[model samples]
Target: MNTLYRLGQFSIALTFPALAILLAVFGLPAVLLFLSSLNAPDFSLTNYEAFFSRGANVRVLLQTVEVSVIATLMCVIVGYPTAYIFAAASKGLRMALLVLVVIPYLTSFLVRTYAWIVILGDGGLINTLLLELGLISSPIPLIYNRMAVYIGMVHIMLPIMVLPLVSVMVGIDKSLSAAARSMGARPFAAFCRVFFPLSLPGVLSGSLLVFVLCLGFYITPAALGGLGDAMLSTFIAAQVESSFDLARIAASSFVLLGLAAVVLGIFGLDLSGAQDSRPHPAWKSPPDWLRSFGAPTRRVKELAARHRAKRWASTLYQAAGRGHLWKVVGTAFVALVMFYLLFPSVVVIIMSFSAGPSLHFPPRALSLQWYRSFFNNPSWTDAAWISIQIGLAVAVLSTIVGTLAAYGLSRTFPRLRSTLTMTILTPITIPSIVVGIAAYLGLLKVGLIGTKTGIILTHSIGATAYVVVIVSATLANFDRRLELAAKSMRASPLRAFTRVTLPLVRPGIIAGALFAFLHSFDEVVQTSLVSGFSVRTLPLKMWENIRHEIDPTIAAVASMLVLLPVAWLIVFYFTLWRSRPTVSGVPLETAS
Candidate 1:
């Protein structure tokens, strides 16, 4: 009773456990890493100088920037029109299209990357089809090239760009464009002058999200690209494998971090599309000159309107005729975009059941041999089991800690909440390899490395940030009076919270737990660094198999991985979607 009372008195204390874990695991280590890069106590620029002095290092840095810029541009080019169509869609159609976009976004990053490998490999789908059609003599080097790198990257990043754009575009006033049209602007002119400017924030948000994420490109570039296609993250990972040179590694990690920070600073980061949702003024007064000239002209135009009706009616008819054609073109374009996003997964799922020892898109025979191989094999089963245990632990821990932190932040001043929320999000907002290196050093200090405890802790920091975001969004809409009413009825603070507040916020909590589990389950970049090569989670195991051997068993594994997102989507629909009020709690659905 006393403890509950004391806890209720200081709501901010609720954030401590999460903050403590973050500080120990990520924050402190990041500071230490910065110091390590500077050779702290001695404090020299030698390490950084050494890094830039190398021609290969400099080239990789430049290449990372180039690739990220090109990929971001590609996403913008493809995503803008798709988003426009999506926003203009009817409610039911928009909802369905959103689900389609999210399925790939929520799918395992590793699985998606692997699907591209299966499709683009010499023996994979495209090449094989070409050979059968007698269109090509050889595979044409599809898999391991710069072009494949762009294809895989753009596929993975398209949803990130589209989702934000659609969110902003949907909230825009359709009447604004109609108003422009009434002012005698053509449809394209109206869109360019009114709609496009308003959607820039979404574009900025999506582009920042994609570009920063791409700056840290690791798994896809390494898996799909040739040796010359290495990003900074690839270089950093290779250095870690080759040597445990702390200063050099820290220098490289900070350099990558600095690159991300510079981009964020340059473009101005706003992961939350809050600006787009702000209510527009119902009407803005016309300019003095326009108002002065408009009254006489309006009456004159009204009198002349019947005279121009024949020409106007003819224009309307022709416009309506072209509208159907544009509609068909838009529908076809959207269909192609959906195909590009989803076809790879469909390919992998079909190939998973192959009776053959190696990958084949259209297998001569279909069997459950690969599935049986995955289950019966001890190595695969053990890794899966280990991953489950760790995921459960991370989910539970992150949910509790993050929910409390979010609740605390909700009670805080705006500036303090913003600062603390950003602090909590540090693990996830920066590159994974940077976070991984920090986690490794932190865990090393505490002797938790190479254990499930270390991996759980490593996964928890980022997972907790996800939880905070979801729960905070839910709390933003929560009615505080319910808890107060419960307390007024003589219920204790804990009782009021557990009985009233918790139930109201339960949906967000559940969604957060799901996201936390998924975050941990799909993690490989940080897991690999912190595992010290001793622990093997499912993703780690799958990554190993993908890199080392060419086995159809991996197809079975990848197929199962693909289903996880589909399952998550179904669960999300029931929880966040149906719940209505907290629909934004959908994981990564927003850049927020």
Candidate 2:
């Protein structure tokens, strides 16, 4: 009974700080959004009605769904093979491939999106090279079109699809294929019958993740697709910033939110059915003679355990071993995907050094003139500063809020936990542009427009969901006993958390914070609406510059932005690595 009381006290202590943060940040803002949607003039569904009435708005919403679905499909098609190859490769090769995939993810999304602009634009590398090679007589209309939007979005979203698939694929048993092969099946047939079926979970998980993320994407599509291929995000931004129609904005947000919820629910149901349908193999105990031989003596039991461990280790080593031909093919495939991921960003970084006024991939002469010009521009510097300020604030605030939300949900009842987690993750499902519009409408009465505080608050609100999900994943792995120990020592809940829980969960907090910072830093749609002429973020500045004209200066700015997060990721990886145990066999707790 005393033990139970101590455990309860510790859980409450560890959970309350996180809960407080969530209530203040996510809970309040979400409630405000729901209220604003229903509270215009008189309680009515006018906003929702307005959303459906506009043909262009409805078209944009459909387009957003279509593009996201298509892009997610492409990501899965490409990502599945790449993930399979990675899983089949040597450990060194796999780690290298993983790093290559992750590096692009660490870079700013806006910068990477802008990089596609230079590649797909008129007189850009793709067209210029094609024309020079006589592959085409004229430049193709790749930029400001659906093709461009799909290309840019798929490029950005591919890694998101690949990582999750890889996570699941690595756990699959290689012997499954061998066992099928021994049963008279060909290698391809064996894989299809054995490996592919097992990989379905990863495929589905990656697909859902990519699809959800793509639904809310604004920067890449806006930059690459322009007016011809405007998505729901762009439409929402236009409604909020250009038209200033609060009712329309609120209605559109509600509809987008509803669509996201429906899609997620369908995906969840399918996943649940898949899990349920899988046959559970019965567990078998070790032979009675073996247990009897081991005896009740510690020495005999220890010897038997060591022998069993050695056998398992040998099996794992043999399983990881693959043919040379398979290794080469896997390496090449991983290299190609990594190239596809990094190619555009490399082009932009190289162009940043061009002495020319316009974007030139392989400059006739390389110089730092563009970098000089970018630094000299006060607007660029100011925007950079503003983006940094907002990003840091959002990161800190979101981390605090997300940690709390994660704790609260973790301690709550299991059935309610899923529902709460879904609510917290809803911001990611709802397009950022819709969130921007909703916030713009809700804050109008409170006079939050064009202020730094308003933009930070808005960015933080969207960012909190990401932090909550990530931190919650980390908290899931945490041992309840550590907190109980602290409580048993007669420590106050707050003191126990600060001294015991905080140190252990710090990594997750940092990871969540890093993601939150990047979320705000890369965001353009929301920033565009909430920010006045007085507060232009780096992404907004880049958007304006691209709208007006394309120059090497923008490329220079992008290169720097790309490097900042990459550096941070490197530092973060090393910190995590240092904290982990040196022994490879150590049981590491997973965040989720």
Q: Cα RMSD (Å) per model?
A: 5.4, 10.3
Cα lDDT computed for each candidate against the true fold: 0.88, 0.74
Q: Candidate 2, residue 481: CA error in Å? A: 3.6
**Which regions in candidate 2 have their CA more than 4 angstroms from the true location?**
1-58, 134-137, 269-326, 482-500, 580-592
Model 1, which residues run further than 4 Å from truth?
A: 272-319, 577-592
TM-scores, in order shown?
0.90, 0.81
- 1-592 per-residue lDDT for model 2 (tens digits): 5564476544445345544444443455556667677774478876777778879887888888999899999898889999888887788988888888887887877777778778888889899999989999999988998888888888888888888789778888888888866554557878776788777777877788788778777777777876767776667666655786555666666677678778777867232112333522323568988778655697886787678666655564365355677768866877788888999889988988887666676888889998888789898888888889999998987787678767766787666666666655655655666666656655565687888888887877667777776777667777768677777888766666676667667777888888899889988877777776668898888888777775558888888887877777776776565675221234345422
Model 2 TM-score relative to the real fold: 0.81
Best by TM-score: 1
Global CA lDDT computed for model 1 = 0.88
The numbered model that scores best in lDDT is: 1
Instruction: For candidate 1, write residues 1-592 as lDDT tens digits.
Output: 9897898688788889899999999989999999999999899999999999999999999999999999999999999999999999999999999999988988888889999988888888999999999999988799888989999999999999999899889978899898887756668878778888788878888999899889888999999999999999999999999988999999999999999998887876743212334544434889998789787688787777665555555575354667789999999999999999999999999998787667687878999999999999999999999999999999999999999999888887776777788778878778899999999999999999999999999999999999998899888877787667778889888877777677667888998999999999999999999998899889999998889865568889989988998898788778766654322232223212
Error of 1 at 582 (Å): 14
